[model samples]
Target: MVLDTVMTTLHVLTGALWVGSVVFVAGVVLPAALDGSLDAAPLETFADRLVYGSRAASVVMFLTGGHMAGTGYTFDLLLNSSRGHLVLAMLLLWLVLSALVEIGRSRLVEGLQEKRVRSPARNAMGVFRAAAVVGVLLLVDAGLLASDVALY
Candidate 1:
């Protein structure tokens, strides 16, 4: 029981970190970049920091989520339960967000390293916006899963 609780807590906390970072990037960083309030070099540095933090949080969430699922849920429960469906959705969302952020980061870093005149900020902002939307959806799903009201 203690182990399960620990795993659940870790999973929630890590997930929150991942979601929060994405939202911040989308709501704050992207706008600043778009508005010229943030220069390319500073934007790139901020993105690097966000990527590093998000990557670490994603790994922790993945591990803890897997552990929680394995220890606390049966295959049947995972297939049939509302929480199971939410978990699956969250996993898919995580994958999409991770891929978008990593690819965007790589492209941005390459452009910056080459000292190209054109900035990748536009592309990065688009990616961050998409990820933020998905993150919000994941949060909604989590809230629904946690609530006592039946979803199905």
Candidate 2:
């Protein structure tokens, strides 16, 4: 029981870290950064820090999945099981995309830091848009997967 709980906590933490950073960049920071004269250096540096952390969290989430799966849990129970195959699959996909976003953000930040700003805000805004689009896809996937699962 305790092991299951611990694994679940790790999964949730990493997922939150991934989601939170994306939300901050897409829903708040990027738009504001676009409209203002905030120095690219600070924003680039900050994005560097966030990219590293979220990527690490994504790794943890992936690592935890192996052990969670070894427990002989039935797959695709999804939200019904709270910690099942469907959840893990979705998490895996999310992680992959999160890593992609991190890579894009990292490259853009590096460009800005190198005085290679081909428009930092515009480039960053593109990354943010991609993240938003991925977020919506994840939602739709989850809803479709949950179609037959009973909810209270």
Candidate 3:
């Protein structure tokens, strides 16, 4: 019970941090990057900050989730448990985040390289915003999952 509680706490904290990062990147940084003057150094710095933070949060989230998966709950039980839904939601968020990092950041860098401040920034910002909204929804669903032993 105590271990479970710890794992749950860690999991929730990881999710919160990840979602919060997503929101900050999408809502704040993205817009700022889009509007501000696009210098390669500055854009690279901003992208580095976002990427580092995201990777850290992603690590924690993965660890806590992996811990849960390694517990007494068999694969089938987890697949059928409330944890399952939360895992799926986490996966969806991960996919969006990974895609954003891969495509969006690279595109942002390319935009910086080519000095197309408006379109590339706007497009990257749009991707971030879309990811943020979905991440928020999935995080909420994970919270709901935390509160219940069964979500389906």
Candidate 4:
């Protein structure tokens, strides 16, 4: 029971870190870059941290989430219940958000490599916006699952 609690806490923290970072980058950093207020050097550094932080968080979330699912749910339960459906949706949303971050980061990196700002920031903003939306959905789905809200 204690182990489950620990795993759940870790899972939630990592999710928050991942979602928060993406939102910060999309809403704050990228906007600054697009407005010519930020330089490539700092942006590159931030992007590096964001990429690595995201990767570490992803691994932690995956392990913790798998542990939770393994301990609390069976294959049958995962496939047959509304809560299970939410879990599946969470997984899908995670994948989508991860991909969006990767793509956005790539665009930013490519632009930074050329010492350019506004173009890359503009290119990535749309993807990051989509990711933010999905991140919110993922959080909402988790909340619904936790609150025992029935969805059919």
TM-score on alpha carbons, each prediction: 0.86, 0.71, 0.78, 0.96
- The residue-level lDDT of candidate 1 at 5 comes to 88
Better of 2 and 3 by TM-score: 3
Candidate 3 lands at a TM-score of: 0.78
lDDT of 4 by residue, 1-152 (tens): 99999999989888988999999998999999999999998998898888888788878978998998898788988899997888888889988988888888898889898899999889889998998999889889889987889553
lDDT string, candidate 1, 27-145, tens digits: 88777666667666776787788789878888887898889778867888778987778778878888888887787677666666654414666657677788888888878877777
The lDDT for every candidate, in the order shown, is 0.77, 0.66, 0.71, 0.88
Give me the displacement of residue 30 in model 3, in angstroms.
Answer: 2.3
- Looking at model 3, report the run of 10 residues with the lowest lDDT sum: 32-41
C-alpha lDDT of candidate 3 relative to the true structure: 0.71
Worst 10-residue lDDT window for candidate 1 reads 111-120
lDDT of 2: 0.66
Clashing pairs in 1: none
Off by over 4 Å in 4: none
Model 3: lDDT of residue 18: 66
- For model 3, residues 1-152, the per-residue Cα lDDT tens digits are 89878987987886677677768877776677667745556766777777776777677777777787677457786678766757666677776775676566776777776765666677787777776787788677776776775645
lDDT of 3 at 117: 60
